[model samples]
Target: MKCIIGLGNPGKKYDRTRHNVGFMVIDELIQRHQWKLDKSKFKADYTIVQTENEKLMLVKPQTFMNLSGDAVRPLMDYYHIHLENILIIFDDLDLPIGKIRLRQKGGHGGHNGIRSIIEHVGSKDFKRVRIGIGRPDSSLSIIDYVLQTFPKRDTEEVMNSVNKAADACEAWVHKPFPEVMNEYNQ
Candidate 1:
């Protein structure tokens, strides 16, 4: 079985924020597959889908961002999922908007949620799909920028990124990681 964990804060207040890009992609995946994510399990909202030979768990951690590992570690343990079989979907402030990066293993690059997962999982060797949200202008605070919603002009870019990231995630699930990386990491 494979587990795809989307990192973000829960609640309506954080909805549509740049930091919630993970949630958006996961929602898109669920919607595209017609999967139901209403199950309250593993400290997250999850849905299970069986595709030929693969069993996939689509998860949104309810522990919010910083404490996301608390939900992930336990869920991974319970499902007997290895690091290689896990994928984390989250926003990346370093990349420009509308970009996508798929990586096999790496440090958190200063993302607290990713740092927490590394701490709990005891390794940096996990798969990840990072959607670019871009950095705020030099004059703006990081907090304010991440919490802010995308502008109307960037709506198409945001949606396109989400869709592509979702497609990359589905490909990652069924195909090899290198294949996904080649296809997504442009």
Candidate 2:
């Protein structure tokens, strides 16, 4: 079994915020596949979906952003999933807005959620699907920028990026990570 975790802060207030794009993409996946993500265990809300050769558990960590590893470690141990088989989707501020980057393994790049996961898992050898939310041009604090909502004009691009991310994820399941990365990470 492989686990796909989407990092986000839970609650309606964070729904459309840039930081919650991970959750948004997972939500899109669940809806598209008709998978029900109602199970609450392993400190995450998750659902299992089946493909030809894999049973994928779609997880939204309810432990919130900072403590995401708390949810991931147990699930990995119980499911016997290796670090390579685990895929995490999260927002990145370094890339341009509405961009998607698929990387096989990398450092957290200063993302607290990814950093926490790396600490708990004791490895950075997992696949990560990073959706670029873009850094703020203004002088606002990084925290404030990520927590804020996107403007109406950018909603279309954001939705397009979400769709691309979801498709890339589906491809990731059936193909090699490098192939997925090459195709999606432009």
lDDT of each: 0.90, 0.90
Scored against the true structure, residue 163 in model 2 reaches a CA lDDT of 95
Candidate 2 lDDT for residue 137: 91
Write down the TM-score of every candidate: 0.97, 0.97
Clashing pairs in 1: none
lDDT string for model 2 (2-65, tens) is: 7788999988989989999889999999999888887888888998878899889899998878
> Residue-wise lDDT of candidate 1 within 6-116, one digit each (tens)?
888899999999999999999999888788887887678888889878999989999878888988998889889888899999999999899989999999998988999
Residue 41, candidate 1: C-alpha displacement in angstroms: 2.7
Colliding pairs, model 2? none
Backbone clashes for every candidate come to 0, 0
RMSD of each: 1.0, 1.0
